[model samples]
Target: MPDGDRYPLAHRLYPYARSADQDRDAGGPAHHPVIVVGGGPVGLALALDLGLRGTPTLVLDDAEGIGEGSRALCFSKRTLEIADRLGCGAPMVEKGVKWQVGKVFHDTDLLYEFDLLPEAGHKAPAFVNLPQPDAERFLVERIRTAISDGAPIEIRGRNRVTALETSQPARLQVETPDGPYALTADYVVACDGARSPVRKMLDLDFEGRVFEDNFLIADVRMKAEFPTERWFWFAPHFKSGDSALLHKQPDDVWRIDFQLGWDIDRKAELSEDRVRARVDAMLGEGVDYDLVWTSIYTFQCRRMRKFRHGPVLFAGDAAHQVSPFGARGANSGIQDADNLGWKLDLVVRGAAPDSLLDTYAEEREAAADENILASTRSTDFITPKSKASRMFRDATLALAARHPFARAMVNSGRLSMPSIYDSYLSMPDALPDGPPATRPGAPCPDAPLGDGFLLEKLGSKFTLLAIGCAAPETGLAVVACEPTPELTARYLGAAPSALYLIRPDQHVAARWPMADAATVAAAHSHACGATT
Candidate 1:
């Protein structure tokens, strides 16, 4: 985090090279099975997933490298898990600052504190604060390794999508330093972000609310004694009467967010002198620090009504938008990629019906709704538009400081949690099962195994996990193991034994107390969207 050059990964990682993809436009569009339109985290994760599934993929990115700064620093556990499955989690975890505790304050007084990860046995931590640019770089590096190992993935830098034809085998007009080229794909995933050119070309728009408030971000590199915890303040005594947040990132960088109500002088607020004055007040007189990055942001809670349009699909910010308060933006976008990847792969391979892709749109649409609702509430509570609302919020904060019950009502930010889908693919739960945590629709919880973790065992395949039971010949690969205490507690608290049908994305599709070939076959068929 040098002040001179900022983040090391900020320099171009991908070099632009001229390709003959342009000549394909003369005859017709060069056809691919799947194409991703952005090189950001979501796009890269999705491409990596598809390639790992043996689906040939090509990523057309406008830029040669990731964006600068610690743009989005909070990567959720779910995001890390997804990255692990994509073979890039180790580097991401190594380069991140992990924290699970958070504190909320009203002025100088502590209201209440919360722990994000209360228990052990999970593989990924609650959150890892790594710069987004570093994350992208790591994912790209992993993709390079996978390509070397023969994973049918190609990323072309400086290839920008200028136009799109959303018909079946969606066509794209791409511009590069060399010239313009055209290509087509059976499906085009738009991870081009909130200002998505793909969405605009397809004439799509987001629907929801935009917050009027602005928050200034000052990412400063310093040697601070502050603990690795998220500290948020409301009506701080420090000069400004607005809310603020302090979070530590990797490489001794700190992210400070100062809420600057509705009206703000963008120029003055961003000035070196003004930013330094604010930092001085927060850190007290003379803390030597170098400003690495600074920017102002106003957030919105919005999503497209439909994520799928004919042959084109949307993920990440292209599909939905939310305020940064809850850490939902990039986290949910990566989850979107997670959900869409396997389904698209199965569809492309002709192993599942094209309608299976509909579940991606539906389930992730539901998740976007969940995130939007939470983010909207956090924004409203943080910046009350009405006098009455502000007074009520203040009173609630005051009460939360003393009473424990009121703590639930105080919303600084809800934080990101994986969506337990009411998915059409989800099977109904049987009574008498203990692990609602591993319910049919929920993301599988990682538990310790003999040598590795349960998630690592699940890998990126449809797996049958039979615990304390004999493996049945269900035509699906099975991992039959004795029930460990953790597995027994999570899978069969009251029951004797359990068998779980896991999806390629590691989400539980179905579970039963005992294994039978007929039953397992039926469940597997249903989960895979097999035609009867």
Candidate 2:
């Protein structure tokens, strides 16, 4: 609490809000468990999950409504599991296009196509494209309904946080429709975008390199369409030095990005006629289309050194940003909210020490670094503007034109696989010797539960799956997730054996051998922070 938070107006409006003198004047009902700024998918999802768990939260966004435009449409299965937990997955999934194979093409010549279903056993596959605005609206409506239902959360639109001071307890001075008012909360999480005002205001260094070349993106609604099963990558087209990517979006629309070498004036080069000419060169002669929206942007792959400064923590783009290759932008941000929600839940409930909150930086920073590296690799390989690098990329795609598997490898490299946290402060060195089961540190494989439902049926909480045995009493009272032997056998093609433990975040926590009471208890204790 600060002097501003104790003002008469502040006291009158937020009487229940905590203040420096309020603790002395009798600490009121915990002033909003956490204050989250930025109501994008990351911030809103975080608030929704926290609210569902009965924690009070305040979310502020400057915008009048949910975000619009065609940005970040790829949703990973892990993200789906998170949305399922928050109870908002089905609607968003229904609005997107699910693909099995994403093909790469070099100037109308097929190079490689990847089947995500085979690589990760994800029946739905990797990376789907949809209008971001539609997804955001669905989430916003769900959040509003929860507020109407009396969830302990408040969302203030047209409100911007101007100054944030992170002293003993985090405090933010925000500008609302009414006036400037101060808010105090136990913790603050910033989910603001790349040019984060909070990051700049705090003077934290966003250390990374920005690429010099700029790219032009155009969204077009076309009557004639390409194959829905593929994503096109054009290299050295027309004059042996042009690069571009065309991805299909929902509603018969397409998003095309052209790497128009670094030096040309964007105004002169990116005109509608110039863009239409480029599309014609790749599609060959006559291609009818109407441009919906277009913009030009440079790529920057930078990350903040620290995601947390005292009580303030950064999630999503506020924490880091990467080149938009692999659709890492929003997908990674959603993962950030998922990772932080559980840790914040634990800390607020006093189930885990405040030190557990530090793991947020360690885990998400590693994920962010992976995004930067993958994006940089894709940019260098695909849009190599340098003479020498261009020659190399040309030679590489030419070779892939002959070999199919070689092309799949390159495309898979760009899909941006989920980074595992084997080295985190949490998790053990190795899975304890187990009878035969998926162990901790492994992504949980989807199996079948009884009554036609599947293993995917139990993801909202930490799950204890007993293969051929009943739930062992570990004293933690974890949900007993029974496995259907017939379904497990059909999927894994092996007889079901041993036990499987799923974390609250839907990751495999540990596997035990033959339902040994002691080992099961130990694994459960560790997963729940009892032993640690």
Candidate 3:
């Protein structure tokens, strides 16, 4: 009963689905060249990528094994692309449920339904909802294989990195059941989570506002079946205080979250019976379910003011924690790895300088701040204080459901739109002063190519697009990819005036009617870490 549309898919689904650690490494001096503090998805993904790049990494986790808990199930297309690059996407694609349409309902009343796969693209919409543990397992297996293939990766379970100190490089003092041992690395990445000891030990400032409201989350197997077609979101479930969310997981499991207002007895309120009763109240009579897991937690939208400190860097929840409204936590964390992976590869290969690491803070910070604003706005909409805000929230969704453009806006907020980066290092060629064109620092959109491959295939590397005009013989070596026909028609009001340069991450690096020495130099300088 692993959710809907079950298929006998690939076996490698959720790479980190390692069996619980039954064997305890009798407290030994297990040291690697580079040690990853957290063994969560981010840390694991980092280890996998590092291994692929011929770097030996040590992953240490306090947990006995991978997590089975259903937290952060949604994976964006960008995330899938990263997984595919790691050779782990096939298994994930086979096992996970592809959600094409996301329906929003207000107390059994259908408000709006957005088809995530808007047009010709991957069959799996813009995202897939796979159990977090499954994903972790898939990755863990991959790491093990890489290790067998001479990857210097050692996964030490039940080992916690208690303290961190930097000398010439950086050092981690991990506490095991036996004793504390010292390990050093060229760099240390703190993906340990929100309550990261690394961030705390370093005394790095996590700055942001904390909302007073607490949310009660429960993963349960429902006795009463509901349509898997929609995501039920209620502002105030049957009252002005109680709120609930209904989402589907991989198995025949539903994850329900209730915003149980500002006041409640923390100790007594989270009891089993209390949770069961609350679920019954929301769905109304005859609703029965077996609670698989239950937890109460409060969150604040905050990010480490600085992602990098000396040789230490932060990823995932350790770097930022956004309200779960947009499913930003795990997705953004994975992207952080994506951002860092290639850059680190380049730096290690001497293709890029250490300064390239600075872009991690710059690009990711922008994304984090955007997530904060979006999550805060969503929370404000649902947990409205003033009458006007409540009314606006109601009217906005109501109106948008009827209007196409407005409908897009509503979906954008809910679907967690791909983040854009506006770094000080962005080039002028990418963002020409002329009317709005697909520019750098913007999430690259797909356009049609002749061979049925989307423009993105060419975008895996830095590209220069020529839409209408003849291709210019600029001395810079870049992928001169084609533009989307729709874009050419809409933006140019006709065939596009050729030459648009794109980045390796698929962002538009430079757009010109024709490529020239000035634009080529500008694009190269920007992409090669010269602008920074």
lDDT by residue (1-532, candidate 2, tens digit) is: 1112111121111112223322333443235569888877888888888787777888877765654346666676656656756777777667667765777777768776667666442333355666666666666777777878887777776678899888757777777656666667788999888878888779886889788787777777776557656465665345322566667777777777777777878886668788777767656677777676667788778899989888889998888888877778877888888778877888888877676677777878888998998888887776665899877777777788887545643532377566565534344423343422344554555543544334455555666666556777765434444445543543223434556666666666665544666866666556555534
For each candidate, the alpha-carbon lDDT, in order, equals: 0.89, 0.68, 0.68
> Which model scores highest in lDDT?
1
Query: Can you give the TM-score per candidate against the true fold?
Result: 0.98, 0.85, 0.81
Q: State the weakest 10-residue window (summed lDDT) of model 2.
A: 5-14
lDDT of 3 by residue, 181-296 (tens): 66667778888998998888988868997877888877777655665544746554454234567677666777777887677787666787787777777767776656776777
lDDT of 1 at 104: 95
Indicate whether candidate 2 or candidate 3 has the larger TM-score.
2
In what order do the candidates fall by lDDT, top score first?
A: 1, 3, 2
RMSD of 1: 1.4
Which residue runs does candidate 3 get wrong by more than 4 Å? 1-33, 149-152, 223-225, 235-241, 386-413, 430-437, 446-504, 511-522
Would you list the clashing residue pairs of candidate 1?
A: none
| Candidate 2 error regions (>4 Å) | 1-30, 119-125, 236-241, 283-286, 404-413, 429-438, 452-455, 475-496, 515-525, 528-532
Whole-structure CA lDDT of model 3 = 0.68
Superposed model 1: Cα runs more than 4 Å off = 1-3
Q: For residues 1-532, what per-residue lDDT tens digits would candidate 1 score against the true structure?
A: 2354667677677779876676654667788999999999999999999998899999999999888878888999999999998888988888899999999989889988899999788889999999999899999999999999999999888999999998887888999988887888999999999899989988889999999999999999899999999999988878553899999988888999999888989988989998888889989988899999999888999999999988899999999999999899999999999999999999999989998888899999999999999999999999999999999999998999899999999999999999988778888875256578888988988888878889988888889988888868867778778888888777778778888889988898988887578977887877877757
Most TM-score-accurate candidate: 1
**What would the TM-score be for candidate 1 when compared with the true structure?**
0.98
